[model samples]
Target chain A: MSAALFLIALSAVLALGLGVYAGRGREMGLEQWSVGSRGFGAVLVFLLLAGEIYTTFTFLGASGFSYGLGAPAYYILAYGTLAYVISYFILPPVWSYAKKHSLVSQPDFFAAKFDSPALGVLVALVDIVALIPYLVLQFTGLGIIVQIAGYGAISKDVAIIIGALVVTAYVIVSGIRGSALTAIVKDGLIIVVVVFMGIYLPVHYYGGIGAMFATLDHAKPGFLAFPASGQSVSWFVSTVLLTCLGFFMWPHSFAACFSAKNRSVFRKNAILLPIYQLVLLFVFFVGFAAVLQVPGLKGAATNMALLKISVAAFPPWMVGIIGATGVLTALVPGSLIMMSASTLFARNLVGFVRPHASNAQTVMVAKFTVPVVALVAVYFTIQGSSTIVALLLMGYNFVTQLFPALVASLMKRNPVSKQGAFAGIFVGVGTVVFLTLTHQTIGTLIPGLPEMIRDLNVGIIALGLNLIVMVAVSAMTPKTAMLPAE
Target chain B: MKNIRLLAILPFIGMLAGPILHNGVEPYILGMPFILGWVVVWILITSAVMAVIYKYDPANAEGDEP
Candidate 1:
């Protein structure tokens, strides 16, 4: 009956209830499960996409980076805004294509557009592998939130198992609608918590925002600004560009584009989503406040700075609310991507293997795979918790290689042949994995690289190689005259 | 509207150029340091720019379907 446990129980029950409510009266179809019947309004789509945006990485890791890495953390805010800007151009065409073709997932889009089901299967395989670490990242963050909230009475392992079970059950029963419904509540709590933490913490401890910056400036000069050192300016620019390209490539976000009511909904979201990016500025504020208040937090301990400061400043009940917010941050996105990943596997990959599967059978397979995928993520979370963010970045790197293929299919003509696209993706993702595993600098993979290439993100290097191979191979293939799909 | 796609690059400039131009923490604006302040300004400017494109871009004129 303690405050922490009470708040935890309350939020869990509320989330489950919302999940069940969202599923009521909706027919059980692949379209319903994957795209929420393709009937959601601008507000619903906004909430769903926003739910995917403000994950534990945003709430916890954003602040952690601010405390630990300083100015490099602004890349989070920059990338988000740029993503919305890019979405203005990318998503409308994608939405109309999916609507016209009755596509349900990323691989579905690729399969139909490229007129190659084999490529669809390949895309599905790559995306599902990329998503596993992402799922692990969320569950690991969820366990940390729960354990901290319980004041160490509850262990991280038990919390992670319980969280995985709850999320799997809700997603299996309600699918993406469950995620959208829970997002409304989750975003509401996040707004209040972010505003409170942003303003109150800075003012209470350091007198005001201006004063806090002044003190930090004196203590650690250039900490509030981007360092021209190891984390260089080129790193910032390339990271921002790479993230913007890969943002919507996440299966869940790409699928949410199909759920939009119309093309205008995406345009409106592009205009409105920047307002949401403002929230990260406040989250950054929370991290800056923690820098001096809670010093010397090393390694995994840095991720706890925001929470530790909140517990010290606020009452246990309020701290519990913050804890619940953190849990939802992980749970909502975790449920969503799991649903998307499972549906992708069932529809695209499994369908390729079986060659004859009904829509009803595919839906059943998607539901059945939820717990299997959840348990795999749970295994990874327990084995390797600290590398969650690195895993997420690796996912982004692999997913961004899909960007060129997407652009070719979405915008270009027969300039990119199927063979070219396939080879490009293989080489691009292979380079990323190899460079990452060998711990080689992406820009300096080859000796005597230019400063621009050396300081840039490795993902961008792989993307460049991807585009080059795609174009070169396409030009070598025989030309075929054909009308555009649109 | 044919040129609306060009507006996409505006955010890249606002986000990328700010650090290369004013990476130092001086000339605080509205109580925020210069580099951080540049990001905030661009977020606002990107919204306004996208709003302009949305107004002229005819892709969404088809209206909502039931």
Candidate 2:
């Protein structure tokens, strides 16, 4: 076998081996399969959370955006750090409530907190819709890595199929623990590979990082700074603020919070995660390095910068290692996200419909739904969309609409009734879809707005409208018995 | 401790303000580009500030068991 094939096979075996090994002597109970039975310490929880947040987007998309769009890419680093700071306050409360009520999913948190099965069902449906495109993006990313690394020996479609099967199988057998174990390997490799390319490419091409930026400064002018055109400062601000709020709104992220042993786990993570975010800076270095060396990669081709640089600089074997790292970056997070969506469907939606369902039955439904979700994602991936980062942003936009309702649910007097919450979500998600479909930029729906307002991210706009509707509707509706006395 | 809940907004301000206030390429600090250096500094400061707030926040009282 060629070195690429051999290394790819080695990565496959390593992922599968670690995945299966994690399931040893453990029962496939719903709790164990979903949240690791709430037994994870700080280190394991930290890795799992980091692995979930840092996906193909971190490994490929951030660099691609930096190489292509310039200053807008900084939002990736800004959001991660801000999100962790937000988590220091938000996650512990949610975790405390989740632990108190045995909530295993994001929808479950909403349902129990607000005392509305209907609201829970709505949250579940919206989450699944937002997440399917995200899953498809992962599959597409894996296909890119495998196809590029295969060098025409293996087809992209077959590689994607094999990749999907590996993730689904390990998730079925080992559950979240499999994702966590593989995450350990995935993260270790990612750090080494990214750090190596980060340092190597810059020094080899442009003397050093400072020299790379200095060269880009002279060659490309404002490319090293925020653009004075198109994406304004407000866009950067709103994107960071909205993403920080929406970070934990993803079902899998909320579910991961429950896996921590205590609130202190989250507190500890908040402090160190910013330091972990330093990894993205290294990824940024690679993008800057590529800007001068590998110029003229247009559109979707820009996503190939890191890989192109690695392939050009390293031997086939080393390139294989980088390629495998990229594949695992997609696989580990893909499994966790698939599992989270399935849990939302099985526990939140199905259990709502079938209140008499047993834990065993719920576990079966969850396990069964995992592959089906993957299949849907695979179907979309085969069709292929070049909007991987856009899909992720859309996901965040719709999910962050839940922030007001979530805050209300945790309040002493949640004035927002279930009716208000449901209406707000529909409006929020609807607005996101409408704006995205129409190709309308943020703060521009009204037309003739100043560039500052027009430059804000659409998610923040949708969220603003959603919050308004929530407050207005709640004020008009009479409180049900479920509403606490104020 | 009384106003520690307000600390959450600081990271937002720190992160978003970089592009608005200092979107220049000059004055590179510690070998990083200007905006990149600004972000890294805020990230470290955010961590330190959060750690300080975590120590003082009453929600994290050692005896408070969930």
DockQ of each: 0.71, 0.70
* Most lDDT-accurate candidate: 1
lDDT of each: 0.85, 0.84
**Model 1 misplaced regions, further than 4 Å:** A447-453, A478-484
lDDT of 2 by residue, A203-253 (tens): 898888888888888898888777654676777887788888888888888
What proportion of the true contacts does each candidate reproduce? Answer: 0.80, 0.68
> Clashing residue pairs in candidate 2, if any?
none
iRMSD in angstroms, per model: 1.8, 1.5
True contact recovery of candidate 1: 0.80
| Residue A214 in candidate 2, Cα distance off native in Å | 0.5
Candidate 2 displacement at residue A137 in angstroms? 1.6
